[model samples]
Target: MNATVNPLLVPDPATDHILGPADARVTLIEYGDFECPSCAQAAPAVKIMRDHFGRQVRFVFRHFPLREVHPHAELAAEAAEAAGAQGKFWPFHDLLFAHQHRLGEAHLRDHAQQVGLDMARYENEMRDHVYLQRVQEQMQVADQLRVRATPSFYLNGAFVDVSFGLAHLQQAIEQALAKG
Candidate 1:
């Protein structure tokens, strides 16, 4: 029998930003960049997919900032980590994608405030670049996976090409659901 082996490895829940049930049948992982327009476009669709799938699918997001092209992406990802430290990761993440065009220092601060993160803590972490290594580690995982672009997705531990359109993602999810 010819079966496609799942190439993507399972991400650590302790370190990864995940949504939905831990025991969900399908796991969807996205390696994204805040400054990537394609990632911004996929954000809402990801949310919708999570909502629609409910407990059936678990979603995880990892940083894969293409720093050479996206000048602010690395810092923006760092800010998200600071927010995560304050237990506001999801909200801050949504805000980052919502305002992808405005990812400067000031804008990141604004997002931190909007998410109700403790300003002092957020500022301190950002200043220390505490999350830089975490972000870099995630990027290294992306490199290992040969993920060349923002918004690359892995479903049920297998890579799913969404470059054509996110509709393919939905189709893949549906197929996964059907199989189970």
Candidate 2:
């Protein structure tokens, strides 16, 4: 990676969890926690950006689960990764956030079943702690990036300092698009 590259824009060392169009002109990388209220609030804005921008922009979600604030965050991230093994990451991810209050181990299992994942495999993977290291690696990267909040974003390789609202995201995306 380039020395000048913003840490937030760097690909996470954990899972290859890149989201959005590959050839998009603008890239928005978000570092968020599954249990963070702010991140939960930002979810819809992210969806809107994806819906509106379509192929014009790319969005990447990286884990920055603040375990101190949200004890079940790491578990949530692991559950998502486990779901990824079955190509159901996004569905599981949305489910986690949508039911943040109910994210216990059993709930994770229920989600896995609801998403049509093999229960045996999901339970085995979850027990084996397959994705824990990956989730921790992402958290370490978040530390390197100095991400201290629930929802922090980097747009077009630059750190975006603002609230995680649709207008703020739109303005940042527009600026990034204008730059190119």
Q: What are the models' TM-scores? A: 0.95, 0.91
lDDT of 2 at 15: 58
Which regions in candidate 2 have their CA more than 4 angstroms from the true location?
1-4, 12-14
lDDT of 1 by residue, 1-180 (tens): 013544346757778999988788888899999999999999999999999999999899999999999999999999988888888889999999998899999999988988898899888889989999999999998999899998999888788999899999999999998888
Stretch of 10 with least lDDT, candidate 1? 1-10
RMSD of each: 2.4, 2.3
What TM-score, to 2 decimals, does candidate 2 have?
0.91
Number of the top lDDT candidate: 1
What's the lDDT of the predicted structure labeled candidate 1?
Answer: 0.89
Residues 16-132 of candidate 2: C-alpha lDDT, one tens digit per residue: 576765667887788888899888878887887888878788777888888888988989898898898888988888888888887889888888899999899889989999899
lDDT of each: 0.89, 0.81
